[model samples]
Target: MRIQDAGVIFGILGIVVMMVIPLPTWLLDFLLIINFSVALTILLIAMNTKEPLQFAIFPALLLITTLFRLGLNVSSTRLILGQGEAGEVIHTFGSFVVGGNAVVGFIVFLILVIIQFIVITRGAERVAEVAARFTLDAMPGKQMSIDADLNAGLITEKEARERRRKIEREADFYGAMDGASKFVKGDAIASIIIVVINIIGGFIVGMTMNNQGMGVTQVLQQYTLLSIGDGLVSQIPALLISTATGLVVTRAASDSNLSQDVLRQMLSYPKMLYVVAGMLLLLGVFTPIGILRTAPLAGLLAVGGFRIQQTKAEEAIKQQVQAEQEEQEEVRSPESVVTLTHVDPIEFEFGYALIPLADTNQGGDLLDRVIMIRRQLALELGIVIPVIRIRDNIQLRPNEYVIKLKGVEVARSELFLDHFMAMSPGIDDPRVVGIETKEPAFGLPALWISEDMRDTAEMAGYTVVDPPSVVATHLTEILKRHAYELLGRQETKQLVESIRNQYPALVEEVVPNLFSIGDIQKVLSNLLREKVSIRDLVTILETMADTAAYTKDPDMLTEYVRAALARQITHQFRPPGQPMTVITLAPNVEQTVVDNIQHSEQGSYLVLDPAISQKIYQSLNEQIQSLATAGHSPLVLTSPNIRMHFRRLLERILPDLPVLSYNELDPSVEVKSGGTVTI
Candidate 1:
């Protein structure tokens, strides 16, 4: 009846109960209990110990042993229950009997064993993973962030003083737990010890029971044989099933069509379920040798799928990189073509002329000069050319200033041809792909075009015309068009420069009221002054003047002057009477022009809004009411950017009425042209 005597009595009764009637779930419950108890003991010891190694190494080993035992028990039971007699008979016939290949059967058997091992390993892994989560969840976030110099517990005032008396240590008082090392060491030691102990204890117990004549050993021995044999046999099918199971699980985790809850439910089933399915399917195959071929084929397909995914990802990445590289290349390439010409005069009418330039070392000097000239032209034209295809023939006359000649020309011409041929033997040869002709003057005319030119024209749905006809006459038109496209107007550029030059006094006065960032100083600086040609100056000035409207405060006034001057220059110089302000502008204005004027709050400006003007015509009823109301006797508006239609309301209303502009408007009146503007 004493406490010690009572404890002994209870222990004996408990052992009797366990041995007599084994519960199926009892093993699982017992293992979990042992696992938690072992963990609790180690955790308490770790908290008290200064060195983590004391608790770290032993505890993890104990847990692993518990996991292994649980997995072994579960796997054994599952294997026995799930065993298919039909499947085994099929495996036997297909592998050993029909296939006549014991090697294949043995391999299949080994695979099954491996599969069982994998299931056990997976269960063990999952247990460990869960334990890790528990450990992390219990850890204090702030403690986790503790510095190396810190200890497991905060240093007490007394302890801190004592520690300070000694040398300062670099490492923390509570060293980090070597989880992996402990895991290995604990599992190895505990497994070996427990296994040996169990085997020896079972043998002793068996002999003792036999000597007692209880016949307990006979029953146990039979069960032991059956369990071990079944355990072994179970492994063969398990191996194939487990492998298939792993793949399916991983894929489901990645992209399952099932709802999350459904997927979770499916996952809850022991992964060994897949192993069972795989084994059944494998065994059902008529030929056991098929497993050999089927396994490797399946494995190869899995590997190939992974490789294909990787290759596709890499290709997409490469394509993105190549596109970016091309974009950068386009940005960096020069804008226009300008090189030495070698085409004969007769062929010049065809548009493009080739330059006779060789890649030879000696010709580098000429090439450099040509490149310099091309660069200069690009800067002047605000364009960059990418390619220069040179011709293969050239005729160079040295230091000759002959205007015209009769008889002397024949001898001179023959000598020139001979010299030229000698200089370039490849010239005039039939083997050359390019043309070689002689008649009249001969030289190459440089052509320049910017990428922007092509892109801008393309956006407007127009073809890119690089080399325009009537070079001399069209040069002005080309400049105007380019200026219009880029700076809004050709005159705007000229106006800004004129203001910069003629009104240095006015610029100094009004500039302070204009530029906000002080950048206007550069625009005003004589040092920044470029000796731009008349044409280029006009373009630059116009672009600069247009920016004035948008310039930060301190710039509004100067911008206004620049715009007014630009307007005047575009109009062609005119002297209207100072007393009257006659603003003879386009009648039906573009919406954009109207918007800009409406927003130009710096000063009042005159504009005929197209919408309002059209409304007036609707009210007037006459065909030319819109034009007449806006004071446009003969209405005209035409450009790629602008299109307007006006009925002849004036002619319909009063055909004999005097024409307004020709009669009253000043002949010296200036007009603005080009760009997004109204007539």
Candidate 2:
């Protein structure tokens, strides 16, 4: 062990040994001085700490100090009864300090005990208990605040974690202080009992066993003086520690230490000092107390208050001048305009009436829901979603909200806070009457119904959802639709670094060696654009490593990656034991797309005749409408070679439609033909 650690261990052992072994008077005197010095040091530290957690070890220290004092008492009591003297320190406290009078010394000791045990210790104990209870009760609210700050980007993840740790430490410190305060109270009671035992026992021993021809009166005076001195010596340190405990438990967290906070806060208003000064002067003049005694103090107070007022006025003027100078500098600086060019990746802005949806105090949980949305998207999309910036905008209507992606509005909707949206189940019921509307997410027929009609809507086979749920659902779909735009080269590098921790060789071989971060980002974005999960990055990287040698085209590489993730895509569209329903493209359409492909220096493109493109779009629309009539999603199945080209043709008309090649389907899954698209 290190020297410092060993010394602490040995010191504790020595304190325990002091209770058992009889010590010399000189050694006892030295220990008594050390005990007093340690107590004074503790009181000073308690006053200097700005917050209680700064002295987190105080509870344990209190236990150790109490034990040390008790050991000293045991040793001193033994010496007093056996040797007729404890130490020079105790004798001086008895004779010189108290004027050789036993009754006066006893009264002094009693006063110290009353101040510590009844006043300081009792109040500190109650404060500690209440503080601990309140700290524990406020934990949930504090945790939510940290999460809100994190979601708002006000603090980093590491800072939020550190804040949470501090809150827990505060709770623990107060709880321990609540129990440790009892030690000081118990020590006070033990001191009184020990003093009585020492006096009574000293009398019996001095007169009978070791009297040396002393009488009862002389024996009583000698022993009583020593006993009271011992009580005083012990109680002095105990009283200092009790005061320290009161200071620690009652101190609220602030930026400054005890003295600085007291001066700054108590003297914040200089006018209060003037009122006290006037009161002092009035009392001296009206009563017969004589003006000479109070006039000097009153004059000093008035001067101090006047100077403080003048200083505050000067500070206010200085601040105003500084602010004006800063404004002029900002107007002339080029960086001020440059800062406005930056845009958030994702933003959700609502009108004034929608404030309660994001405010925790008003029962709003939108911030918490945003956090969950990010986590859910991360798990499902295999990419960390950027922090969504949410704020209020006055230009929008009270019920309107807009979702923006990279400074462009992608989706907007309106919500009725007091009503629930209930979508009909195709069999409309006249009993479920309400305001007609459409579901913002899917544009399905819906009605805005009241809280009382929620059960009625459900009973009538309508899907009922609250306003927050509607907003959350709509936001989730918008993010999924634009998940590709959120993933950039930086985000791709983060994913690569995460993979490198586990599969270092695989990442080193694929990234920067065969493909750059931008190349990998493009492939990932292409997958996300089609609503495919990129969570299986390992498999995607392996596929890129295999095909990167022959092709530098990201689209081709993405196609190869999809074929490798056939099982994932198949499971996504076709559930377990369910046949996949899809519309098949005719041979003519597939051949025409393959035939129109032209290669360039940049990349390949499908240059189809405008008439052929129109005919193809019309054919695909017919199939989609037929699928919708049958209550099925529109999924197009095409040849492996023409799948990318066909998807590009339908990108503008049916961006959300799922297009898959035969190679991207698992062999075990059965495919059912829903219809055919022909031109």
Candidate 3:
């Protein structure tokens, strides 16, 4: 072990040894001084610390110091009774420090004991107990706050963990201090008992066993002084330690140390100082106390206040100048432009009237709903959604809100805060009539009804929802639609790292080795674009690992992955025990698409004539319209070879349409052809 660590062990052992074994006067004097130095050091450290946890080891240190003091008392008592003197230190304290009067010395020692045991130690013990109880009680609330901040993306995972750890440490520190304060109280009582024992024992030894033939008065005077001296020596250090304990338990957490906090807070207002100075000067003038006595202090206070006022004024000017300089520098700096260029992945901006929807104090729960939206999307889409930055924009109308994707406005809507949106169920109810509007999310014809009409609307077969729900639903749909755009290279890397932790070998085989992160990101983006859930990422990666050697194209790989996830895709489109209704490509259309397929290094595209493309589009629209009329979603079922090319062809016109291959359907799924797209 290093010398410092070994020294602590040896020192604790030495304290134990001092209690039992007799020591020379010089060594006892040295130990007594060391005890005083240690107590003073602890007090200084307690004063310097801004928070109790900064002195976390103080409880154990208090115990050790108390023990050391007790051992010294024992050694001193032994010497005074056995040899009529402890050391020069004790003798000097008895004679010179107390003016050779035993009674006066005893009174001084008792006063110290009262101040420590009754005042400082007692108050500190109570404070520690209350602090411990409150800290433990507040732990759950503090933990929940941390969790909420984490969910809201106000803090990162590391910060949340650190905050939790600090709370636990505070609890433990206060609990330990509650038990440690008792040691100081007990040590005070022990000091009084030890002193009494030494005096009584000293008197008996001096009068009965002395060969010098000392009288009662002389023996009492001699031994009483030594005993009181010993008491005073021990009590001084104990008092310092007790004061240290009180400071520690009472100290609140702050950014600065104790002295700085005290000075800065106490002197924050110069006007208070000036008023106090006036009061002191008036006391000196009116009171019987002489002007000479208080005049100097009053003048000092007045001058100090003036100086502080002047200093503050100077500081304000300096700060203003510094701020201006910093602003100028920031404008000139290239980094300012760089920061302006950055954009959030998703942003939800609302107007002033919608503030109550995001504010928790006003009973709004938009933030909570946003958290749920992120979690819901993660489960449904298999990607962690980025934090949605929410703020109020004065540029918009009071009731308007907009959702932005990568700095571009994607969707916006208006909401009447006090009304409920009611959408009709096919047939309009004249009784459920209100301000007409369209649903922000689905653009369905809806009515903004009053609070009184909510129950009537529902009873009239119209679906009703609150303003917050409308905003939340609208936001969820927008995010879901643009989730693929949010999954950039960085987000893709995070997803890869997440899976790497669990399936390292599988990730190692595919990522960067066979397919780079960019290649995998493209494949994932393609799936997400088609409203596919990549939640089963391991299967996707495994599929890629198997077929990566044959083709590096992301489109072809996505096709293989789609086929691999046939069951998921089938389950996604076709509900359980339900027949899937889809439009199938005609033989002629399929052959034409295959014939027009052109391949190059940049990947394949269908190079069809404009006339033929128009005919194909018209035919596809007819089939899709028929399916919609039949109350079925438009899904094009084509052969595996042409599915990817066919999707690219009609994506601009029918972006939401699902193009599934024959290989992408599960065998057990029942498929009924809705219509055939023929040209």
Candidate 4:
């Protein structure tokens, strides 16, 4: 049996031994005092500590026991040394063992104490069991983090709430049912039987002691136990101790919420057996000294049981740490990806990259093979792309190739025609005749016009290289380099100037001419489209700056100028759909919006999409400036993407804005489908 189980059995035996053996009066006094001290210590600390202080229990009990033992020795020495008369001792002993103080009151109190202990233990056990089961259902994983829940709009919010409620209700129902059944069938009946038997036995044993006169069983005479009228007055201290032992045992057994049943069992393994044995031996040693009058062994049993109970608390903390580790590992496995919300801004940049594809075999001539390759590339990358093939004298731009294979008759005919055309009247230059025939003269360009010219190559795909050391790699390298350069710089001045001078005609022509969208948008579009910039963000703080000046109903003059500049630089290069992180700010910070912009983690030092972040920064700066100009204290607006307003911008210096006041909001920003409204 477990150590705690052994303690319980030993406690029962100790109670029996007290009534049957009728321990010495001095010994009974020692038992009473020690029991009362142990009980009071338990109660005081239990009521005081917010969390159970397992370490305090042992020392507190020991100190109280030592103090009481010393007090008992001093008081008992006076009584044993003939300090009182024989008649007085006889009257006191009879009153203490058989009088009202010991019989009715003690019996009533023990019953109540046992019942209270049972209720407390059973309730705590139920709570732990329910909590363990609840944690199992909510284990953290990829499914819990990234997948759209009703809150995210991937699932309906109503559905998510309903599911959560259903789980809570089901758990509550099962827990309540189990608790009710266990209490009714188990502890309730056992408590009634034990209390009744103990009270009856104590009464019968006390009567036997009354007949024996001032013997050891006559508790009041030989000891300092209070005598009120006819019996020994056992104070609140002894009752409190017995009740405390029961309470501690119940709490120790019942309060585990660990999901691992095996661990709980290990923690609860009773160490109380050793303590019980030690207490039993101590009870015998003290009994010979006439210390315990009626229940020397009972005090030892209660103290031992309480000690074991205190030691079990460490198990709860250890189990909690174990559970967290297990759950963390389960959440991080390969199949699961942890999608973290950006509490603060985070940015990553990638430069140019080319991916090669697997080769395929087809039974086709060179020209057919080339056409097939072009079709395959288009299918893989999801775009219709231009391909250039170059070999001999004829140069191929995109979608064109040249070959220089000699031909006999056609070449001779072309030479004869060229000579005749040189002598002809209208074709004096000989070039006009060649042009009329859709051919070039000798020493000028000419083509044999083969029906089997190579259009596409099948087996392999090629990548671009910078500097074009090998002719084919040049095109890709140039485009990749342009993208990388765009990340760092704001605009290309030459492209901006050209687009500004040309307007619509240039905008239309420039887009197709550029290698990538970032190239066109970063340089040209900045000059023509909405020119959102850091400088524009700074302008919003001006005195009397209009609230709508940043976006929606911007004053248009400054906004338009920035847009025009952006159009010149980056109109063709900008990417679609801006992504934002949640940012919160301290309420008291001045210039909340503009100050936080420089530190935002939304982009790398260089960005693939600067226009998006630039626009957000500008709008925030303008709002803060507008607030300052209006004479309002700066207040931060928190959202997935934040807007800060510092009313009364004119009153304060612009350089004093506090940027570090920004913070990443919890859970990040919530984004939903069909959420964007185009302006």
Better of 1 and 4 by TM-score: 1
TM-score of each: 0.22, 0.63, 0.73, 0.21
Local accuracy of candidate 1 as per-residue lDDT tens digits, 1-679: 6999998567445444543443344453453344345445543443344332223344334334334443543433432233311123222333344253434444443444443444533643354444445444544443333321233234554664544432121011111222332333333343334333333444455555444354655534432332333233333223322332222222211222234435445444434444554564475465666666566555554555556556667978999999999978776666412222232211111111212122444332334544554465355433322223333323424311111111122111111211111112222222222122221122222112244334433444432232111121222222222221222222232233344544555444443454322443333221111111223333333444455567543234333333334433323222243221222224454444444343355633435466765554444334244444554432222221222112122334433222112222234553432112133
lDDT by candidate, in order shown: 0.35, 0.91, 0.91, 0.34
Which candidate would rank higher by TM-score, 3 or 4? 3
**Candidate ranking (TM-score, best to worst):** 3, 2, 1, 4
Comparing 1 with 3 on lDDT, the higher-scoring candidate is 3
Where does the lowest 10-residue lDDT sum fall in candidate 4?
Answer: 349-358
Q: Give the distance in Å from residue 104's predicted Cα in candidate 3 to where it truly belongs.
A: 6.9
Residue-by-residue lDDT tens digits, candidate 2, 1-679:
6999999899999999999999999999999999999999999999999999999999999999999999999999999999889899999888888999988988888888889889998999999999999999999999988876665457888999999999999989999999999999899999999999999999999978864788888888889999988888899999999999999999998898999998998879999999999999998999999799889999999999999999999999999999999998998899889878999999999999999999999999999999998899988889899889999999999999999999999999888999999999999989888888889888898999999989999999999999999999999999998999999987887777666657989998997899999999999999999989999999999999999889989999999999999999988888457688899988888888888999999988899999988898888888889988987777889998988888888888888899999999999899989889888
Which candidate gets the maximum TM-score versus the true structure? 3
- lDDT for predicted candidate 1 compared with the true structure: 0.35
Every model's Cα RMSD, please?
A: 26.7, 8.5, 6.4, 28.4
Candidate 4 RMSD to the correct structure: 28.4
Error of 4 at 543 (Å): 58
For candidate 3, lDDT tens digit of each residue in 24-70? Answer: 99999998899989999999999999889889999999999999999
lDDT string, candidate 4, 462-532, tens digits: 11111111112222222222222222222332233233333544444433443233433332222222212
